[model samples]
Target chain A: MAEKPKAFGERYMVKPGKSFRLADCDPRAANGFSDKDAAKADTVRDAAAIDALQDKLYAEGKRALLVILQGIDCSGKDGTVRAVFNHCGPIGVKVQPFKAPTADELAQDYLWRVHHACPPRGFIGIFNRSHYEDVLVVKVRGYAPPEAIEKRYDEINAFEKMLSDNGTKILKFMLNISKDEQAERLTERIEIPEKRWKFNPSDLEDRALWNDYMKAYEVALTRCSTHHAPWYVIPADRNWVRNAAISRIVRETLEEMNPKYPEPKGWDPKTVKVV
Target chain B: MAEKPKAFGERYMVKPGKSFRLADCDPRAANGFSDKDAAKADTVRDAAAIDALQDKLYAEGKRALLVILQGIDCSGKDGTVRAVFNHCGPIGVKVQPFKAPTADELAQDYLWRVHHACPPRGFIGIFNRSHYEDVLVVKVRGYAPPEAIEKRYDEINAFEKMLSDNGTKILKFMLNISKDEQAERLTERIEIPEKRWKFNPSDLEDRALWNDYMKAYEVALTRCSTHHAPWYVIPADRNWVRNAAISRIVRETLEEMNPKYPEPKGWDPKTVKVV
Candidate 1:
């Protein structure tokens, strides 16, 4: 009898040149990549590479990337952001969450507040919830008129396009947790004394409107997922899997961007003797 | 020679405990407790702990913490918050920077907007700039009358006292960088092309009012420092030192709080079996 295949990490280690698409490649089949063990090993190696690349990007200070995360209630957007960017350099990363707008914020165009939060060049900014909310939540809750909501779709695409033109890369991730998973998590919050405070009675109310939210997200993704600012639908049932997948995607994106360290102009290394 | 006191992690080769204090420790010291190295290491470790703790706290439904960081501009408050808490759990950690108030904020009592931003128990919230700004910047800029400024200080102390009475742990850190250091950092920002964007021409105008700001801070600290909630003066001249010191102090404080895992009242661990 043939022995069971070893994990991917066990079979082969991850190298620098490899693409970070583990979900796309099966590890067990003959034509596939290495098995699960090898993949785990690859992930560890990839994490280090991601760290190095992040440092390079930070040092170069060329262009910045804004990552907008949008999803329904209990969708794990915040968790994914933390896990994915945990290993990245802090200097170039900023996370901003948009709560209910203040009177000042309401007075300005929806994008006005968001543009101010944009990360500087060579940095990464994550929007826990972003302007897309104007179209999604506002539309779902009937807060904005239909015409205004419709106009926002074009405005978002154009806004993202402008960012791209200005050398800013944008990536949007929509965490797609199954209803069962979200309910289970929410139930856990209710059952655990420590977690009880996190349970808002209003979350159940929001859950009732889940379908509307789903539709809103579907439209948002369809309309806003442009070439400049693409969206990835991530399955977030298993926390470990979600973390791994997001890390892989981010690593791949940075590798593709090929961030490099900017050389200090007019520096004569020969003049500085190294003992 | 005393054999370098058998360096803790270096010579002893012990897996160092993952905790730190930033206020009193030197970051560059030989032990893993050095300000800079400890800060980085503490961040990675605390990130995981904070993640688990937040989930537990959220589940338990406790009151949240509001950590107010106050310092002169360029004192490294932003950098400290970024490095130390970069990996902290989920969106449970919210950073609110209180800039010059808008017309609405100005119209209300100084604590009005701040009271709204204070985290509910069980969450760890940070104020990059906080209610103290009403006393610090406003007073320094002569935005309020001298008597009004004095009253605001008394009001702030009372507000923070109420928060502590209600389970909020207020950890305020004043990143105390020397004037010379600030000058050096500002010069670096101006000289480096990549960092030119970070240097706002208006910052010089603010720099000119350094003495006024310092006096304002001294008054705020002296008035607000209490048995329940105290201010920690953190030396911020060295980046690593500041990071380590803050991380250590934060870690120690949390440990002292002894936030424990709350059990589900009726759940039996023995009966829980993996399917």
Candidate 2:
């Protein structure tokens, strides 16, 4: 077989239709990076570049980027958003966290709400949790029949393909933390009085389902990885590395896309007269 | 007749029903602190303490703190939030920015939406621009009849008193910036390409009303700085000093509230048998 791609992004991108196991990846892998301070500095540099790209993306006004962030509990999803996009203006980026479906949402098909939440052209929409919940939690909790939930992998691929065919570029990240890392986080939340508000006893219930969640994620990441839209299984055990790795790819992707501000048709600024 | 209170808190507190001119206060006042770096360090230190206090507030679960931040454009309200509360968990503090009222919000009594957006028990609610806009914007722009707008001052006092009579404590801050400072900020927003999104041509329209806004603010600050919900006109041209001053007052207020974690009723650890 051809040697697997092993850089910041290509290493993390799940191969299409291959026998993939999430457990095969180490959560502590730094993608050849070792120095946290250096990684942090690089991330900051990338954030500024991301800001420049976002400026072009807004001025171009023809394409959108949808970043889907899915993770188990205590996976640092919100932290990633703040760190990676800190330099980006709030007006240019919209973070739509997909909480439990509301009554209005439950009235429609599963993808109906997801469709409405997609980023409009010239904007970046970040989904804290996303449509994949139909496969992950919905399947793990038996919220739907096994056959019905199993069909969603194909449905999701189709949905994402449609998004790509339109002017949207999609990047999905599974913020993968080890079971032990999660335990440390949960314990810290419980032991530290200041962190107690973030602690929920029900999170322990989810912790008990760790193996089941891992399996669900493995299936989703493997089955849904596609050319049109790909899933990146980000090792999130270290915040610095996770931020650096994701920001590097995000900046690289926007550079690849190379959006430009459109000039008005047959017009020059000097030719226009003010009243 | 009385010695004027001049510590950080009382120095800036707007005296109720007294003649107040925002221009009379210097935006450069650092309250004797000359070191900007030291003030920033202290602000971060106090932010951690605020986090501890917030933990107790959550555990007590019977009271709320509402921080009202009002300012002209480019006065660093959002920056103040990040500086002061970045250490506090997102679960503990919620920021609600009151933009131009939506159609549904405009249909109700002005305070109706403001009341709906109040912090729940155990949460810190930061209002970026708040109900004071009724007096500030409504009065200055002639959005309401002169008699109608005149009555809103007393109405707001009553509304806030009701909130205080219930379990909420309110602290309002007017981020006082000089016209020169605002001009510099507006120019930077216009000149910086990445920040161009935040620059609206209509913002200049608001700038033209600077003198009217100052007058309106003087009236509101004097009339509405009641014992229930007092206003503080902070020296906001210096970002570090603004943050330090606000952090000092917030940490002090929370310390005074002195919330404590509730011990579980009738449940002792010694007698419980492990399964």
User: What lDDT is obtained when candidate 2 is compared to the true structure?
Assistant: 0.83
Off by over 4 Å in 1: A1-79, A87-231, A235-245, A248-275, B1-52, B263-275
Candidate 2 off by > 4 Å: A1-7, A16-19, A44-67, A78-128, A154-170, A183-205, A226-229, A251-275, B1-7, B17-19, B47-64, B86-94, B112-123, B162-168, B187-201, B258-275
Question: Least lDDT summed over 10 consecutive residues: which range in candidate 1 chain B?
Answer: B1-10
Q: Which whole-number lDDT from 0 to 100 does residue A102 have in model 2?
A: 93
Specify the highest-DockQ model's number: 1
Candidate 1 chain A minimal-lDDT segment of 10 residues: A8-17
With a 3 Å backbone cut-off (N, CA, C), the pairs that clash in candidate 2 are none
lDDT of 1 at B71: 74
lDDT of each: 0.66, 0.83
